[model samples]
Target: MKAKLTDAFVKNITPPASGRLDIVDETTPGLVLRVMASGVKSWSIRYRPKGRKQLRESYGTYPSTSLSDARARAKALTAAASVGRDLVSEEAAAAAAKAEEEAKAKTIADVVADYIKAHVAKTRKAGVTEKLFANHIVPVLGKKTVGELRRADVVELLDSLKNKGWRTNAQVNRVHAALKACLNWAVEREYLDANPAAVVKKQVTERPRDRVLSDGELKAIWEATDVRTDPSRAFIRLLILTGARRDEIRCMTWSEIDLEKGIWTLPKARNKGHRDHVVPLSNEVKAILEALPRLGECVITTDGKIPYAGQKSLKESLDKAVGASNWEHWTLHDFRRTVTTGMSALGVREEHRERALNHAVGGIGNKVYDRHAYLDEKRAALQAWADRVMLIVDTSGPQNVVAFEAS
Candidate 1:
């Protein structure tokens, strides 16, 4: 009736004639091996709960469970039962808790998807922002849970970009900002306790850029555009003439322009300032627009439908032209600064200059209360800027003008 359960005994034991055979281990009390008529053996513990009938809990199958492990598990169950604790209920609660935690733990990639859908996708730069995260953040930390993400983890990710020279310091800062925004959104949604990036400092120190093009350099750049084609030539000229952001010009649609009115009205969606921006097109700028064939909805497009995406090639051609002049280093964005700097030198008032560049000025009162579009002032500034640029380009030495090779 009672004996020590061993591996050899389990393998040699005979199947019962009808139902099953129960053998209790005398060495370890209450541990039993039940051998069904089909010869299947399983380990279990039978215990009398306090003020309740006896109950059987199957620990595992015989051989697989092993005699020692079954006895250890049975002993623990017996101890719990003796203390009036219901082992079955306790185990079930623990199982449910583990399952709930697993269900609630969300990975970084999961949060990013939700964040993009709810927040980033609605923004104008959604495509760029999405690509930034995909290229920088997602590959390394996507699988890590938000709660487990620490400051060191974020530093590692940013440092990887820096170490690889994958991105510049300014670009690393942008990636950090995107991650911080996503984490903050998580906190606001109650999915996280805090943002790990909140304490992590930005990796790069950003300085105010003061690289303004001189009149000679501007003249060189203006003359260089003649070698380029329709969209590229017009695009570069507009950058100097209108003082608008590159994307604002590149993504310009036919609907946003009113050639008769000599205005380019950028809705809040296309504008970085997130407000309706009206740029007074100079006569020269209007001429470029008038000459552009309406192939599609957008203005600066080779195919007429899609926005121009040949910035890299365009920049190379521009560099070749600028390089010929032995001009100092400059970027396309420098043109905006060039226009702004040039306007200031030409005695354009601060407020109108800021407005011409579509920069938000003053406090909430000015932004919220000032309804004036300053159409006349803006028109005058553009006309003056265009006039000054034309004068500079005309004065460029014959050798300063070079043709940009066609793509």
Candidate 2:
């Protein structure tokens, strides 16, 4: 069918009962209106570019594509085809280029996810690294692509954290380190040309913590923990008694402990040093462990499935119970330092103190040649420390502090 196409004709056209209808526009050559049996109408232009085969391409749908607009587009396409230009092929190529660009444009979050899967997940630090990205980096700069990330953006993020008091200068430095490490990985993998965080200096100078708990403060914390038999109290008591890292005590499993031998064996995967460490349990630590019910696999768990968490809340409750506003702010790690410092004050050998804390003692020669586990030395140091702690917490207990002689 052929006619001078008009808006009224286009809108009022009825669908054929079978097959389809094509109405050629008399006003424009090669321009067509296709009406299907389903009553849907569309516009297209049929043209041949130079020596190429004839091609028919749909331009738009009606009446959304006005009759005048469709005619103009069809004329333009036809004129281009006569001059040996393939408008359809050009459009296709442009679209392909756009898709390729989009594929190359990976966001920071995308690269972080890849980094975690490729590298971080294989290490024991996976949990902390993943949590850092999720809680801090992703929420702030996840949407920005690698090319879009600027040093100013990173500075803004750190400044925002400091301005809001969300993190201390030391903590800001840690976040910067983790973020820089991740970006450096991206650079290594060619996801980024360079790490944006590389030039960003440490926001604050971080001094090593020298806040060892005093005997009086230790006694107060020990007494404060006496009110409950929950996991938090048990966790704190073990931390004070054994002087182990917080997670070492928190993640302790029944299988790792030998009540008969009085040793807790920490596998390399769980420790910060990535070496198997044997922590000698004092009689005090054993008593605390023995008193707890066998609820689950983890020793310090309310449920057996997972280890106890939320140390910050536990610290707050302990501070409130101790009611010591005059005391300096302290961390759970201070218990470990206090134990070592107390051992020193009591004249315990430095090697024994280091061994009790599972620290590497001496040089590479000692580490490679001295395969000795130093179990006995660690036991003596921890036992003496426990004795001192017991006496401090309870003045009614023995007054003499047991000391470990140097080997």
Candidate 3:
């Protein structure tokens, strides 16, 4: 064993190597030092624990980790390990040592990119996930690396979302989901020891989806659609009647609709889930489509032109409709509920209801062949929903709940 000396005496002694090569300090067994050569000046504690083989722990690079501090840390760990602390405990001790500055080593931007490229892109539609990350996650956290990010950094970003309201919160929540997904990947890749974002919670500032519309609200939409000469009114009303996704509606073309067949075919590419779908249309929907001024290839046209471009076109018109009404806190999407709720009240079969809305549940293959040959029953249910919606719009009444014996 090397002779033990006080801290001052150990600090004074310089090894044979040049000034760059350092004698870090004494450890649990003996004096520890390093000889610098390449860009990395690594430290080694050449000592043995009690009843153990000799081994050296490479602490870190030099100048970056000062010789004095490195020696002091090595001595503490070696002392702990010598006292019979297990491997797991030693690892925990090592992690605690590295947590502070090293955690900050990864920037948000770098980790986000890696996580997207490595994991998220593979599972989700690359374009959709890319659009989401680019629009929301990267703007605030892009510059920072994985290690540098902390809980407060995430919290601060979340707090900024409060000003923009629910839609913004939707974006924020998605950003967090993307970040959590990416950071977990970092941990798996050994880029990080643990994911700091796993525990973060999304604050619920907005009310839960109570999307069922009210009596007066129904009346306003009805009056607007009924009296307005424009066919787009009927299209918006059908959106409420059908309960399909807005994108599904926006991209609808004439080829997809069969007036005689009484069905609308939504191609897989246009669906949010990227699956081919068919919507069971109501007579009210049929009447509306029949009345619309067809523009080009789309159904919702005025003078042979697609009304505006996408949902933005539809939303802009709806926004104008909303401005004309005496309303508070309602949107076009509430129609999906309008159909689902209206049907259940009118004794519609659950399977028929789900199918009518083109909701793909029970996986892709099951959805493909789960046809009931009950198109008449489904048409009746959809028509019932449309009737109820019209009744509410016509009379400004609430849900006309007509209970039936359970099937």
Candidate 4:
């Protein structure tokens, strides 16, 4: 059927009884309105480009696509066909280009996921970095595309952390560092052109933690652990006994220890120094280990599966139990400093103290020449520290104090 296409004619047209009905538009050649038996009305243009066979290209549906707009589109398609343009090929190419652009435009979350898989998973910081992103950064900026990231966004993120008091300004500095490092990696991989977090300075100046636990405070904390269960009890005791890092003791595995040799071997991938550290297990530490059941691979596990992860809540409970105002601001990491400080007070040598903490002593010369693991010196220092701890916690027992050679 041939007729001039109008809004009323298109809307009032009835569907065919059987297959379909085609109404040709007299206003625009090659423009056709197809009314389907299902009552679906759609517009399409039929034209042949040069010597090519006739092609039909559907543009839009009626009601949604106005009659005037359909006529305009059909006219444009016919004119473009006259100029040797392949309308179907051009439309397909345009769609492909759009898809390619979308693929390249990765969100911050997408880039972070890639960064973790391609880069972070190979490093020791993988677990903590993943948590930092998941808990802090991702919730705030994950939806923003990499190209859309601005310095303002980073500043706002840090400011929010500070304003909310969820973390201290000092801790906000760490979040900023992690964010900057991730963005830097993204820039290197061409996922981002620049790091928006680069110019974002620290929220506040962080002073070196000089807070050391006194003898009374340490005793109170030790006694508080008595009320706690296996993992928390043993974990805190080991931190004070060996002065090892929190995670080093938290993620301890049964395979890393040799009870016969009284040594806990930390792999290079785990420690901060990135070197295999041999912590001489004092009698106290060995006793704690022996007391713990062989639940699974992880020595400090509560469930016989993964490591214990309730330190934060445990600390809160401990603070409440200890009930000392002086112990208010102390952290788990402060135990490390207190151990080293107490050793200094006990006349332990500087090198021995550093060695006990697995800190690199002296210059590159010492690192190259002094291949000695200092097992004896570290053992002596740790024993002295452990004995001091025992004396503080249990005044009833006769303390066996080990003598340390002077520096």
- The RMSD (Cα, Å) of candidate 4 is 12.6
**In model 4, which regions exceed 4 Å deviation?**
1-104, 324-328
Measured with C-alpha atoms, the lDDT of residue 41 in candidate 2 is 93
Residues 47-148, candidate 2: write the lDDT tens digits. 898889899988889988989998898888789999999988998999977755563488989988988999889987688779888988999999999879
lDDT for 374 (candidate 1): 95
Q: Which ranges in model 1 have alpha carbons more than 4 Å from their true place? A: 1-104, 324-328, 363-365, 396-407
lDDT of 3 by residue, 72-91 (tens): 76667667667754443568
Error of 3 at 289 (Å): 3.0
Can you tell me which runs of candidate 3 are displaced by over 4 Å? 1-132, 163-171, 185-193, 205-207, 225-235, 268-276, 291-328, 359-373, 392-407
Q: Model 4, 179: alpha-carbon shift in Å?
A: 1.4
TM-score of 3: 0.57
Residue lDDT tens for model 4, 347-404: 8999889988989887988888878889998898999999999999999967788666
Q: Relative to the true structure, how large is the alpha-carbon lDDT of every model? A: 0.84, 0.86, 0.66, 0.88
- TM-score (all chains, Cα) for each model: 0.70, 0.73, 0.57, 0.74
Q: Candidate 3: minimum summed lDDT over ten consecutive residues — where? A: 22-31
- Judged by whole-model lDDT over C-alpha atoms, candidate 3 comes out at 0.66
Best by lDDT: 4
